[model samples]
Target chain A: MKILLIEDELELATSVLDFLKSEHYLVELASDFPTAYEKAIVYEYDCLIVDINLPGGGTGLDVIRALKKLHPESAVIIISARNGVEDRIVGLDLGADDYLTKPFHLSELNARLKALLRRRHFGGSSDIVFHEIKIKPAERNVYIKENLLDLTPKEYDLLLYFLSNQHHVLRRESIAEHLLGDDADQMDDFNFIYSHIKNLRKKLIDRGCLDYVKAVYGIGYKFTDKK
Target chain B: MKLLHQTQRLFFRGVLPVFIAAGIVSFFTLRWVFDHETDEKLLGVQAEIESYVRINDTLPTFFQTVFDRWYAEPMPTGSMTNLKAYTFSDTMLFNKFENEIEPFRQLRFPVKMRGQIWMVSALTSTVEHHDLVLILAVLLVTMFGLLLLVMLWVNRIVSRQVWQPFFETLEKMRRFRLADHALLTLPPSSVEEIQELNTTLENLAYQVRQDYQTVKKFTENASHELQTPLAIIQGKVEILLQNDTLSETQAQQINIIGQSTRRMVRLNQSLLLLSKIENNQFLERKPVALKPLLEKRLVWLEDFIAEKKLELETILVEISLEINPFLAETLMTNLLTNAVKHNIQGGFLRVILNENYLIVENSAALPEASVKDLTARFARGNPHSEGVGLGLAMVVEICEQQGFGLEISFEQGIWRVQLRFRK
Candidate 1:
């Protein structure tokens, strides 16, 4: 997938650039609004990760407005340090698909980008199939072979999150946030993460599926098909 | 005490005594002057009798009437020497006609009549003087009473006028809210002291607001500035996590750093939210269905609640409140999360929503004997919990900004928090 990253902060921009590039996407960097605007109008891209604050004579919102007019079907995501209500509403109302606040996990960002691309390209008709595990986005169902995986709503979401970002380490904090937006404020943070994941893993194993989950020591759970 | 009452107290303790004392002194001075004049009149009578008796011997014809009584008596052995000068005495005399003793002013004087020293005693009825003094006393008391009343009334009016601006300032201060946008209203005052008071008060209010804004802006800027670096750190750690050749210790260190960075982000966001609430930034209002919002929030805590097997009870009433929908959802979610998070194992968590209140009650493992400040910042029952320790503090800020009431109580291992919705 082709993606455009418009950010002013050099270090953050580099980290995002490297992360997205490592994800095997054609990621282009535009550190200023003018370059972002020029490249966005001149090139074709699958997704645009725009920061609300940008230097060079224009804000990220302006880039979104200019490029969105040219390509209304483009997947646009707004990342801002200004996470106020009005900022989020303004970005979303301007046809941005999602609004991610600053200091976000790049894994979460990648999942959002992939989801946005999938929806934009196939119109959500694509059934995400991973070997024996299958997730139908339209029907909101997961299947292991012929039998439906009887998973709770939380388990279902956790599985989908794991499937999308397979082989990537997912932090407990990020997982909690992804599951519960602001209510991810858990008393025992890892307990809720552990409870849901344990149940999900048990359900998957009982469905006669090989365990594709690995605990990376003290880091977080990882989904990999290796051994 | 009120200013008026304080001044009136001054009149009671200080001015009123001086008034009473001056009245007494004046009454005594008037009596002395009257008595002196009467004594002089008696001396003239004595002299007149002496001259008459000397010029035409054989006791001058004198009629004894009730109004005037006089007598002549030869000097008794020692009495003549005792009468050196004219003497006056306040004595009682009996009158045959009246058949009652009447007060009299008597004067005795020694006189040489026809070459003989005689004691001439003269008496006059003192009923008139007594009547005059009684009337004077009555009049004086009436005048002083009227003066005191008038003084009190005048003092009341004068104090009310003198202190009018002061009380006005007090009332304006009482009604002033820091969250309001308007400056403290200090109306013009003519009194120099009052005007000075107003100036000082206005300055204090302005300074307080300025400091408040400075701190608020500082908090917001700090939070915003930290966001980029925090994001960079987390991003770098995530990138490092994908390294295949990294050792176990290196991976753990990277993961720990990423977790701490994520925590810092949550902390920053929470602080930003707190300052925003204090700033009254959420102003949009709408009628929100609260039950559904709470039900939706509770679903997020469902896993933990079930993991501990804590019984959950939610009794909600169909009530609507006019508030910012975002704030409303946040308030409900925070309250629910706090209740579920702190509940003990096998303990019950109950949520009851009334028309104007929402109460969350849960059983605690270690019940505090006294009331604790759960709403204070970073006040967590468990320090090691994953919470940012700002949940209840944010709830308190939202409630305070929105004019809602918050009450937290712990009784018999039951920790209860009630949010009283403003009517």
Candidate 2:
């Protein structure tokens, strides 16, 4: 899935970018008003993450407005440190799907992303049942044969993204960009993605559930129904 | 209840009764003196009549007794001439003594009996004419003078004594301050009414100031406490968003967290500002040039105007105002920002300044609401705008504090906000 991130901070943006690449989402980044404004108009994205205050010229609010005009079907989440009631109201009124204030936990972000994706793609259903394991979107739940699979917020989002593209190989850049946006570049390494995936797989197996997440050697991971 | 009414009520209540008592006492005393003067006059007349009776009875039976009989008759009712005819009768004095005693011709009522009647009447008129009239005049004058002296003397003494407790309490009340809830030191008074009045006033004033202080403290504490949590959340969002490798989906989720934190901060700031305005923190003031100051604001807002695609124009350049510079700047910024921020793209912003008035007119497509409500807190006429809605409210408060008059009007897609200053 192609996603656009509109953020102004450099270090934060690079870190986010690195994390999303490991999760196999195609992400594009714009650090200021003009760049973000141009990128939003030119690209097609399944989801967008935008900040309200941009450095160069316009605001993140302006970017949301432009995005809605260009691609009405695109889902958007507004991020801001403004902490003003009027700012939130203005962002939502411009057709943003959700709003978040700063200093949030990554796990919570991941959980919210999965919820939004399920609602947008599947019209809010309970389970996306693969041949081996059933992925429940409504409950942030996974199950293999009657036993429940425990997944952290990030692990759950990663599993859902892979399930939606079963049997399809996703690139490393695509995963990191999709999950972390412009923030992916800040991490010293992308090893956190391995731990998130590793833990998700371990939890399923430990619960006597089949591991459906498959590594593609040099590329990324994929969920195969034939396995 | 009020100063004037209390004065009048006490005048009638305490002073009026004392005045009435004085009047009654003097009335009875003056009546006694009047009766004594009448007794003295009656006694003097009786002594003279007795001497005349003794002189007549010893002289001779016929002549003398007849003269005595004449003197005893009540003086004739009409005039002195009729009474003289009886006193000068010829048959009473052997028929020939009538001409010899023409001296009895002037005998009068309120008779004096030491000399010839005619001679006594002439002498009385020359020495003390209308003696009875003189005595009555003297008595009336003295009685009225005594009444005035008594009224003034009583009012002075009784008013001072009766009002002493009140004046003392008032003096203490004047020294009372709200810095501390000090207990009043009331002088002991036997007057129950005055004691009650002092107690009630002291309690009322103390309670009102206490409530005011409590409300102020609550607002201060609430504003301080909210800032801590807001700062924590904002900081955490900044830290998390610094991490890499978030899917396009993960980054978007963090964005929502940041926006909520910002909203909280703005609410806290606005609340604090409102409290400061209420507490009269902007009391210190100085003269400010309004027109140039407004222009300076436009310079700061130039970038915003360009981004919003608004056109600006100014009609007048110089007008003086008296206000705190900080408050004045804040007020102008809020007004100017609202005009441009809420205006339609490519809308015109016009500012007009005169000696005592300022008007800002901008092109707007505001939702249907009364112009009066635009200055209310949290009243967002346009839901799409990203404003905290405290801008115009702050402007209204500053205008009131600085003693400026505000007027708002809308017509033909143009909105006008006018502020009038004292000359």
Candidate 3:
């Protein structure tokens, strides 16, 4: 998949680029409005991550409008520091697929991009299979080798999120944000995340599946099919 | 007092004494003039009678016909010495037409007729004391009525026209809100005092609005600048945590950094939200069914409540509130979060909703904290607690902007928050 990231902040853009590259997606960068607008019109991208506040005079909304006219099939996600509901509504109404507030985790952004891509490219498929584990997105049900696995709603969501971004290192903060959204900011510790991960790991092991979930040292969990 | 009414009262206070004094002075002055004229007429009649007696050497028969009453008595011979005194006195006489005794002003004079000293007394006309009083009373009443009517007419015109601009400025000031960005406009006035007042008020309002915008801009820029760096720090920490050579202690220390970064981000977001709310950015409003919304939020919060092991009870009535839906949801979420966060393990939570209010009560683990401190920014019952402390503060801001009443109290080891909505 090819994606374009339009952001003025260099550190945030680098982190997002690194995370998406590790997921094996080809990504392009545009730091200002004019370049972003030019690139968006010239080349076709499967997805576009546009920041509303560009370094130049123009805004990302303008770019989204132009890009939508140029490539109607491209999916756009708006990343803005402005958390106002009106801005979100305006972005979504202007044909943007999703809106994420600033200071967000890279993993959460990846998860959103994955969901958007799945819907856009896969024609809204419900079933996703990775080796022995299978998931029904519509029913939120998971099974292993024809045996249904019992998982809480949150656990089911976490499993699906990890499966979508397999082999990518997921930070605890990103996992927390993906699960709790804005509420994760209030948590002072990651003990609950640890517990949830423990239970999910034990459940998968009990179902005779390989240990696909791995801890990347001090960082967080990663789901992979690689040996 | 209202400005118009106050002015009217002052005018009455000043005019009332002058009106009474004028009435008294005019009454007495008129009475004295009328009395002097009557005396002059009586003297003229005396002169004509005396002239006739001197010409004919006898009293005229016209004296008895012209006067209402008359008497002439001669003093004894050799006892009267220069007996030619003239005097006037009031007397009572019987009136045959009205069959009553009426007052009269009488004049007496001594006239010489054929070398005899004759005492002559004549009644000129009836002059009742009450007649003078009645005339004075009628004249004073008519003057008073005219004065009152003129004063009322002037007051109405002055209040409606002369003070119209003042009143308009007053109304504008009443409706002025700093967030609305609509400056007060006062019509130009011919009056110097009102003009000065309007100019000063306009300057004051302009200064205030400028200051408010400055503060709002500063907050927005500060939040935006701070957020990017916070994100960078958090990102670096996450990257560092991925190193396999790191010790457990290193990981724990890095986790602390991550946790504090999260807290800072939340604080920044809350402050930004407060500034936005103060700036009146959330203006769109719709009628929201609050009960269903609350129920939905509760379902989302079920995990949080379950983790706390708090027993939940809800009495949600169908209440419709007119407010911005985003703010309404945030308010409810904050209230529920506070209730669960502050409650003790295995505690009880009751959410009661009625037509006018929503009440959330929870059993507290520690001693009851001050309601003022609890609702303030960064306030927490337990210092070690993970709460960012902006929940209640945001709730309070939302309540104030939305014209809702928020009351917090702690009693019997229970923390209760009540939100009263306008009917």
Best by lDDT: 1
Report the lDDT tens digits of candidate 3 across residue range A1-227.
99999999898888888778877899999999999999999999999999998977799999999999989899999998887777899999999999988777777788889888888988767578999999877567899997999999789889988998777667777887788766555444455677788889999999999999998666678898775
Question: Model 1 over residues B210-303: C-alpha lDDT tens digits?
Answer: 8889988999999989988898898889888888789989999888898777778878888988888888888889999899988887776777
The interface root-mean-square deviations, each candidate in sequence, come to: 2.0, 14.2, 2.8
Whichever of 1 and 3 has more DockQ, that candidate is: 1
Residue B257 C-alpha lDDT in model 3: 90
Candidate 2, residues B1-423, lDDT tens digits: the string is 754446556655765566556656655565456444433443444445545545763212223322222223333343344443111111212324344421111222334233322211100111122234456556655665676567656765677788889889889889765433456667877899998987787788778777877886787668756754564554455445444455555655664565555555656666776667766766678888887788877875554566557888898867667788768877777778778776787899998889878899999986456777777887777765555677788888888777789887888889888998862
Q: Report DockQ per prediction, comma-separated.
A: 0.73, 0.04, 0.30
The lDDT values for all models are 0.84, 0.64, 0.83
Q: Weakest 10 consecutive residues, lDDT, candidate 2 chain B?
A: B118-127
Badly placed stretches (over 4 Å) of model 2 are A1-227, B1-36, B43-263, B275-293, B296-313, B319-326, B337-350, B354-357, B360-389, B396-423
The list of candidate 1 runs beyond 4 A from truth reads A185-188, B76-83, B96-98, B365-372
lDDT per residue as tens, model 3, B1-423: 987778888888888888888788877777777777777888887898889889987877763543266677886787567654678988777777777777777898988889997777778664543477668768786979798879877897878898888888898889888877788777788999999999999999999999989999899879878988887877677666655577878876887797788788888988888788878888899998999888977876666677778899999899788899888988888888778767787999999999989999999876435789878888888887876788888899899889988888888888898989972
Worst 10 residues of 2 chain A by lDDT: A181-190
Better of 2 and 3 by lDDT: 3
TM per prediction: 0.95, 0.39, 0.72
lDDT of 3 at B410: 88
